[model samples]
Target: MSLYGEFSVPTDAFALHYTLEQIQEITIETERVVATEVGLTNYFWVSGCNLDEFETVSEKDPSIQNLRRLDEFDRATLFRAEWTEQVDAIIFAYLEIGATILEATGSHDEWHFCMRFDTHDRLDQFQDHCDDQGISFRLTKLHEITQPHTGSQFGLTEKQSEALVTAWKMDYFTTANVTLADVASELGITPQSLSERLQRGYQSLIANTIVVTPPSD
Candidate 1:
């Protein structure tokens, strides 16, 4: 079975916001999953997952801390992908039940625009929810994800992938100029969180991509 899936629709599929307070609440509830699942159907492209519905939380009020290997975000997403046999399920259906909205702070504190949802869904469900909510969420089908598209190819998540990339991008020599605070700002996350992501990414990078760059003449 495919791990990640993507779908596409008209450009004006999901509106970022609405005027009505009720609509806003719907936005908030569904948003709890995150906007990552908004556009793309594929698992990798889809950003967030239903943190509230996570098994840890479901079993007995398992908080975000229950997740072990990955952060809350990655665990939630993985749960969705692996929880169900069908990879293309409607992750946002939880919204109709008034799922609690956990505003996504920002993605990996990497970029301003990068956002993720704690939700996962098939491209079809994502589109339908957009329609049901009177929004314009769409789907973009990906013909193929580039080789080494991400660490998931090697059983790694985006955060893991970033750590790998960042380490290679910077020599262990120094990110002295680029403080954790700066990285966090770039990623729209707190410095401490950035450090965690960086450390994980660095370890993965070292494990997978550790190699010496040719010395400059």
Candidate 2:
């Protein structure tokens, strides 16, 4: 049976060590990372930084061979960066085990991953490979996927997860009894920023969790 595994690999063991150091709100969904090439042309978001500042930071890191912004949105921008030999082995390891990376996000300290493998054995083999290489990793979750994971099955970024949970526990959505500003203050962000984050989080939640059916013809 196909299995889903949630694991974490420290930044020291992967590439993008410097990019993570410069930006805290950055998230990466690696498109490809190989011996000769690497591409992470995904939205790289930072709460209050601009393109210039982002580039300045990227330039400081030699590990990042190239950094180019493909597009920009409200608080995030898509970027592609090539890496040196450091990340090759790890990327190849995933390929070796036939693992499909579903989601990956993190900073310079550590990274979190949700990957799908053909079976539990493949997941174990991947972990064993990491162990043999002396690469430290922590497995957070492991389960068999019996059905399509969409809508609510989507995973939340750490900040989004925290924000949503906090808001729920504080009853932030219970009418006007509690204001968003109150929740924003508690989250140490501006109300506007909080709203944006929550809105994005909700959109992701709805897209992943909700089941939409088509009408009969």
Candidate 3:
């Protein structure tokens, strides 16, 4: 008794984030044009009452979880109706899980959001769900957009892998860190050449990694 047949939510399709709760919040801000902001038409939620003590803990206290639908187009009405449908789907899924949540609260022609929480193992389960659904969900210890200098998992040349690993360990971020020139000196290569190699390594890793954010275009 349904629209198509049985609720065949493709075993492959799952949620993006592993848990309903998260600590660091990623604020993706965009400049509003004539339309100002894209609004979420509405969101639907269904709840899961089965989880035991964890549910109680989540109910009493929850963390911040956010996913902003960051997309942009010069013109407004480009993907109008379809955008609303996607937002609705997010709401429905969160509600079904007994997750503490925030339904889409803002409006922007191309922006939308939804959030929820779960912890540790529960978070892992959430990530599994995202994997099945083909959504890219990754948690980071640092909030900045980091360029990982690691090689892709499938395959990478030894030198390429080493270059990427070096990029990650450079401590290029902090004030008291050594410069690329210092590392390059140890490697017997000029800093300029080292930078080029690091760039290549970061690009390779990015091509295969699962982290997803707003469209960079």
Rank candidates, lDDT, best first. Answer: 2, 3, 1
**Candidate 3 per-residue C-alpha lDDT over 20-78 given as tens digits, one digit per residue, 9 for 90 to 100:** 23212221111111111342222111122222332343233212122233322221111
Clashes of each: 29, 5, 31
| Worst window of 10 by summed lDDT in candidate 1 | 21-30
Q: What is the lDDT, from 0 to 100, of the residue 28 in candidate 3?
A: 17
For model 3, the stretches where C-alpha displacement exceeds 4 angstroms are: 1-155, 211-217
Clashing pairs in 2: 150-208, 151-208, 151-209, 152-208, 152-209
- lDDT of all the models against the reference? 0.33, 0.65, 0.34
Per-residue alpha-carbon lDDT of candidate 2 for residues 27-125, written as tens digits (9 for 90 to 100): 555432223334322323443456676688778766666677754547655565666544543565454766765556666578777777887777778
lDDT of 3 at 157: 32
Candidate achieving higher lDDT, 2 or 3: 2
